[model samples]
Target chain A: MIARTCILFILPLLLAGNANAHHSYAAEFDRDAPMTIEGVVTEVWFKSPHVRYYLTVTDEDGNKVTWDTRGLTPVKLVRQGWMKDTIKVGDRIKIFGHVGRTNKTIMSILDVTLADGSVLTSRSVAYDIKN
Target chain B: MRLILVALLTFSFGVHAHADESEFSGMWMLDVKIPAEPLAGLLEIEMTDDGWIAWVEGGPAPVTIEGNHIEILVDARDRQGFLFQRKLVGILENGRIDGTLTSIDVVESAAEFGEDGSSWSAEAFVKEPPSQPVQDISELSGTWVPLRGVDFRKWTMALTPAAKEWHAGYDARMDEPQKRCISPGLYSAVTWSFPFEIVAANGKVVMLYEAFNLSRRVFTDGRDDPDFFPNSSMGYSTGQLINGEFVIETTLVTQTVRDFNGEPISENASMTERYRLSDDGQRLSVVLTLDDPDNYERAPIRRRVWTRQDDAVIYPFECDPDSFFRQLFNEGRMQEYIDRTPIRP
Candidate 1:
């Protein structure tokens, strides 16, 4: 059981190390600043180069704001057991990601918690999230 | 009994000569070793009444067969979309062909480097391997995946005064062509964690990269450089096998930065690369020397390695630039990025 647990932990690191991501993450997102949002999915663009999710979140003032979050490619997500219908519209989800350097509403997705309580990691394999 | 023995001897000698001549007539899979990367491709050789003709990945080229020596010239494109020519010379022995791969960018040779090209040693096989444990460390062939742990950007250069000034003001977010879905050229392309297939046929070695679906053709045939040509990202390359190392020289490259750190490579920049495979044929090591007097005080050397993965597949990299910007615009971030970007007059 310990060997299996070690394999599970090491496998993600190995797989994440090879994440091409295509563009430089540091160029677009700020690594120092991390954010989490619980919102309802408005749209999902599952395509090549990258996959984007549009979510509607309420700010501290109770004002609703649309956030654009990016993740890995479709092929990569599919390999990770993510399907087009995995996160449907109106599904309330929680997202953990890094905020964009220029855009506050834009973020690079790191992990997601679906309405069903299942957790799915976005393609920031090289990124270490510190609690 | 003496007459029968003499007749048998004559028949045996005739069969041996025939086997030597026909050995090269078939389909061959090639694993070509480039600096830090291994390219896999296929070669098909055929004989006709006119002469010998070879097709490398369905592209036909005329060939000449002289006893154990084979020669051919093939025309193909580099990763940067430049036209280049490859001249290949091979020697058939024991059901295998081993020879040189030379290249000259038809356009760049004429416009820049007078006439001389480059060459490298390449080998061909009837069957792709891991079947037999490789004994020669110099023979590099097969699919090799990038080792992610090795950061190639750690190699630094002593920049020229002008280059240093340029680097100081560079913005990676705005200046990076790769972010715009443009080909990052040869130097940066080699550093990418993408898979590439290398094919050595008749007189040329071809590399098909999964990144942006780019391909580069290195010529091994004995041909003079052209008189004029245009500059491109990958540039024109010539390769030769020297003392068991595949040596390649590239020139007339397009002006571009070497990496995300804003390291620059001028059009006058040239590169020399040496590739060596491990004795097990599982790892390929490359030494790259960058010479750009306009950008660096002296040539900088970079080393990289790739591990052979027979099951690795090269996939299509279809990039959507519009979608990239759409997210930024939709999030109202485009204006902020533009406002913060430094403008150079």
Candidate 2:
């Protein structure tokens, strides 16, 4: 019965930090650690293995800490309707995902909320077969 | 009765013998269903300038023929890569050679010798040069999307105590070779969510995986074993058509951990896959069997089903080690990761 389950529904299981395809994904990011940050995007490196963004988040201490936020690869993200210029370098956005286990700046992006209130998901399209 | 040992041939796809009953030379296709699963093999005995040289599965073997009595001694490595002697003394009658093959390994001599040894028969098969087949494998050959649901992506591996300890100490950041851009072997290659294309032609099946931009060749022609095969992650694979499905057996793979959980598949680990197509030719299903006697109590079976996606494009998914190292350096843990590694090559 477990074999018949829709494959992409296992993203939640990944959120649990159990079955991962990436190398040491659990070692890089904790399953239980969740963080939401709102910041101004400074750079976006669309590349293989992962697409990362350099965001300057103003902490509560009023200091600027540039966070290297990681997301899905350009291949998987493209299938989920994410484009290269979707989040511009100057655009302000809110990212909700699990924070890194050791590095607080790194994040395995779950979803991103753009300045115009449009939400882009980096999750697998397995949930919807049509997508 | 002194039963002299004979050849140890492991022939599935390719590697066939052109049996010549007269001189007892050339190739012989041996079928021994006794001590093992349909033990399909090949024996090549060729005459040199003066003496005769024999080989079993590309390894040197000994063959002696006199009157109707013949004895063969082949140093065959078992599935575990352990050396063993299998003796076959057969009487060549008509064109078929009938005999009894017995495992001379000391570990299981009692059980094998007590019984009438597994019956084995070999017939002279035509050894032709490898040629392209004129068969239709289009049902299994196409660009398809992998619907890999390893229990819907949850892993519950039954590991041995030795492997359990190895997994408990698994630090993926430093332990996994994929971090260095090496292929993670066939486990993740088939289990991942990327699209892969299967092309069958010219007596071979080529699997182009989009995950690591890796291409694996499965030879169906009766070619010799890859003597100089590279010791890569996926290893050497041979395929045969069983019934209407494609059966692939892979061994000599240079992989330790099997998956995300870091469960070990030891040096003796071998994987077998049977790919079948739905009646409607839309769905391609495969049952993967992993056997590592030292790592787990039992072999694990996983199913990967796919639907034909004609227009699916396979992009380059090469993992860059520089990018990974750069990311680690950005995280300020590059040194820590280096220190944690066990100096693996």
Q: What is the TM-score of chain A alone in each candidate?
A: 0.75, 0.77
Model 2, retained fraction of real contacts? 0.21
Q: How many clashes does the backbone of model 2 have?
A: 11
Candidate 1 residues lying further than 4 Å off, grouped into runs, are A1-24, A73-91, A123-131, B1-139, B327-345
Error of 2 at B88 (Å): 51
Query: Which parts of model 2 have CA positions greater than 4 angstroms off?
Result: A1-23, A127-131, B1-136, B148-154, B343-345
Every candidate's DockQ is: 0.04, 0.09
lDDT of 1 by residue, B302-342 (tens): 55667777566666677767766776577566886577455
lDDT of 2 at A80: 66
How far off is residue B240 in model 2, in Å? 1.4
Q: Find the 10 residues in a row with the least total lDDT in model 2 chain B.
A: B106-115
lDDT tens readout by residue for model 2, B178-238: 6676777886687666778999889888999887787898888868896687666776788
What is candidate 2's CAPRI-style docking category based on DockQ?
incorrect
lDDT of each: 0.62, 0.64
